[model samples]
Target: MRRLLLLPAIALITTLTLIAPTHAADQPNFLVFVGDDMTWTDAGCFGNSEVRTPHIDQLAREGMRLTACFTPAPMCSPTRQALYTGLFPVRNGAHPNHSRIHEGLRTMPHYLGDLGYRVALTGKRHFGPNESYPFEFLGKNKNPDFDAIGKFVRDAGSAPWCLMVCSNQPHTPWNRGDAEAYPPQSLTLPPYMVDTPATRKGLSQYYAEITYMDGELGRCLDILDESGQRDRTCVVFLSEQGSSFPHCKWTLYDTGIKAAGVVVWPGVVEPGTTSDALISYVDLLPTMIEAAGSTPSDEFDGRSFLKVLDGSQQQHRETIFAVQTTRGIIKGSEAYGIRCVRDGRYKYILNLNAENEFSNTVSQDGNIFASWKRKARNDPEAAELVESYVRRPEVEFYDLESDPFELNNLAADPTPAQKDRMAELRSRLNAWMAQQGDDGAATEMQALERMSPRSADGYRRWRAQQRRSGADSAD
Candidate 1:
């Protein structure tokens, strides 16, 4: 009887061990720290001397750092829309900020939830208005409060949780007078912008905001560690687009598209590993799905770079694309706008209407109209930056290797070799745009057609009303 009892006990112990969850520990929690209106070199991990982001730097030290990452669009709404839908901004009628993301889109979090991962988002979740257009992926609502994020995670009642945290800071109305903390002279203004006291003064506030953002992220990371989820969590930190600088925010240049990307997955991704893989906003969704051990559907335009995380592949993209939209700047003026294709060495811009009324003037200044106009007059560097705003030839090219600042335009050169490279990039752009269903100025046409007489008249009436209201209020 004793032997028989012992035999059943042994069998029970074996069964319990075998039935334990295999992915309980292996499946990593997901946390994405998205900064609003940040530039490419804003983080300490990305080699910025003025910025002090110790927590973000620590994340890079604990995981893989991705260089050469670009956003699909320069603007926030379209870029975030494309990143979530895994489609180009044009496909969903989100060419610019005014257009909302279409309803019933299959987003990353929407699909991940089906795979047993709990998903949540907090802070600056710019997924367009939910009343007009809803996303299948977002849980609860868009832009959930920061305090609510932790509560949602705890209530998930699951082992692995995915949280998307976006912070809005360092964009505009910058914290002035804070430039004193950073060496004002050491601020490396982009070659396109002038080195002036005002520029440095603006940067000082921007840096302070970045530092403040860093503190917020540090708090979240500390919470994760305290909850014993550090080892089982994968953290990705990046920005939506560039800062509020002239010629960068709304343009396809490095200032607008290129961003600092850092990922941390302890024990899985090797720490201190840096890869120059040309990553884009499109790659984020597919990569996150893969990390969750789930396969994305064929609908996605991006591919998973699991090899890069494992240190097997060195680079991902050889070339990247950029789009610009200026439909609202001028009324009844519809232009197909500028489309650019950039490799590591060169950038080719196709101004669909170079000679017509829809000409692409020095297309770099995408900031607020007030700030942009001021910079052009007061800042000498602004003049050089907006040089392309002038009427251009059908095509323009810049050799980024030698002229990283993009001061010289070589399209006018009579050299045969330069002409050949220009032709090649043009062909590539045309082909890619055609494939994406974004040939020429179709975006501009959509914008014009959609803008009704009522909307236009409403804007005009609102402006006049505002003036009258201001006068009356002052009295």
Candidate 2:
């Protein structure tokens, strides 16, 4: 809750004079590499030995690795919206994948374009619900060829450019029998779930995807090296959300919301400087704008961390926030919506509606805890816990420091003196929601839970745009 307003000149001075060699007019080319559905502990730098993310790990070794970075939402579309607009997903009305970003808002790439930076994107541009508003130059796809990345950077013709490359490997539809590529025995399982052989096998597949994405990252980095822009370019590696997993990915757990972020710029970010400083996905836009000497819009809730790049700023946010969208089905129909928040140590989830009734009873792949349910039916303890979570409690709380796995709930437990802390946090969160004009967003989010991507307003908008395009062609 520290006020940036109190240190006005400090923020200005830090923004203006942080970078050394660059003149007031010189702008650095920007590049953001978004890894799809990646997690903090999955990367080599963060501590997963089995999952090979050598290139991303190398980027961390060469620059700064953020330990406590999180996206506003645990899912892809909402967090991507926040990243582009520097606002919370709820504030932008992009709470769920089916929801569209308000049309007139200036996006990060749009702002850069106005500043004379030729903007181009390659791979997953899942913005505006159905991803309707891709950059005019490049549309969304899986991964851009390494040779193409090099060609684009080299042929930028002395003008500054911004390129965003995204990938979608580590998501769902797990690779079943690739034991040689990713040995199941070598993988580690999170504590929230029982570490069975099946879990390990699933994890192995996710890691295989991680390894594949690492190769892609290496290709892009190699392209930058060959183009001779590696030194001058400011490279940022981040994720839209966490990997798709049970109680992760689409959920609001740390495994679902937190992402690995690393920034490398030879002389700018100090080597091997790891910071636990909190960073929101929303901050990317302002940071890019500030680094390039472009003005950020007043509506932006995020602040630039360019000082952190120049070794002048050590702290980012003291407390970070997070949210997730819920999914549901009603008599063959679908619904979706959600909103939540987290401080550094505790995560507070306020579900406006019950998960079972408000959304689908099954997971993304329609695996309604098939293995877990079988085990739970046999084990009384597991059955009790599963039943509790399934009932869709109004509030959930966890002590991240002690229960990093987030299996134990302190919201209803009186043994931990949690009620007082919970009340204080609830007050703070409610006040924040009100200030953002989202007093009933939690309730509205419940309505969204039952909505599907096909039924979303965003899809309608996309269809209308397509119709207009068709009409213009006819003319």
Candidate 3:
């Protein structure tokens, strides 16, 4: 395992020089590649020698690797919406899966376009209302048209542009890269998982998909290089949200919301640099805006980390917050809502519907959870883990420095110091929700109202069916 060295109030680059903002005509180009369902720890640069991610590794070696980057929500739609809109999920009215933003919300393209830049998002768009996004759509889900990307760059000539290439790899069905490269017996499972043969097999396939996503990222980077704009382009790649494995997706665990963030700003960010500065997805657009030598608006939920990029600042945010809504997702729990807040070390989680079983598609048939249960019948360790997965306490706290995987919950018997920390974090979390107009469980039940037209209708029928079947979700 490769560990990221913690830098203490050091310069972003070796020079420790603060980069002066460039003129509007000389603004650099931006190229962003977002991978689907990839946990930060699995990123080769972050650690994990089992998977292949040469392209991502190269970026970390030549760029700044953000240690505490996170999304506003664990699911796809809310994460993407928050990233683009520069607002938290609830504030944007898209806190649920398959949800849409409020009618008049503006996004990245709008902000960047006003600054005279061509902004386009290609592939795997979970956003909606064309007016809100307004990106020049390029390709379909999972498949970004590389040729079109190259052509778009060539056609842009000297105009500064920001392009986001979204990928749909390593999500589900786990069939992308070559699984043979990673033998099931040779892999070391994360501590949170059960070491069943079925789990190993699924891990192998999931790893292959991760590598496949890296390959796609390589292609996107190659386009920038081929265009001779590599130096003038700031290349960034983010592992958007965690994988759908248990304790990863559909939860507020660090593994679920932690994003793999690497930024390669040529002549600006130092090579092989690492920053422990915490940043949220909502902060990205504001950072980009500042990078373009423009001012970010006060209405945004995030502040620009451009100073952090140029060695002018060390930390970005005081704490990061995330939410999880299970009402509209496929095979998700009826109203199991979760919220979390984390600083550098401690993480606090609140499960609003703690009485309900924490359920998701991960425990469905053919998934790894069933296999764990089968082994749990005879193995006490497996049984304990299986029980812990579905049954969680309402208030959970973990010292992230000591327990990175979050196996031990300190909330059960908190020390005086721990109790004080928890109270502070819980108070901050409540204040954040109040600002977003979130009423905890009540906000969760109204998820369909924020969903896209297509997703809203489907979930309405599903809710109706659940009612007919005597499954009262309290919706």
Candidate with the greatest TM-score versus the true structure: 3
Per-residue error (Å), model 1, residue 314: 1.6
**Per-residue lDDT over 1-475 for candidate 1, one digit per residue giving the tens place of the 0 to 100 score:** 3234223222321332111234645467888888878887788888787688899899889998888888888777778777766666765546655455544455655556655667666766555545432222333443335456556555655467778787766656666324567766777766666555666666777888788788878878877776666777889888778886655676666778888888888777899989888887888877777777766554566777777887878888878887766553322123436788888788888776565433212232323333444676876556544444434466668897787655677888836877888888888888777666664665555553333344445544644564566621221
What TM-score fits each model?
0.81, 0.83, 0.93
Against the true structure, whose lDDT is highest? Answer: 3
Q: Ten-residue segment with the worst summed lDDT in candidate 3? A: 1-10
Q: Put the candidates in lDDT order, highest first.
A: 3, 2, 1
Full ranking by TM-score: 3, 2, 1
Model 3 agreement with the true structure over 269-345: per-residue lDDT tens digits? 98998899989999998888878877776567888998888777898899999999988887566788999999899
lDDT of 3 at 179: 96
Clashes of each: 8, 13, 0
What's the lDDT for all of these models? 0.66, 0.67, 0.85
Stretches > 4 Å off in candidate 3: 1-23, 463-475
CA displacement after TM-score superposition, residue 333 of candidate 1 (Å): 7.7
Q: Model 2 over residues 219-242: C-alpha lDDT tens digits?
A: 888888877777788888885687
Once model 1 is optimally superposed onto the true structure by TM-score, how far is the C-alpha of residue 162 displaced, in angstroms? 1.4
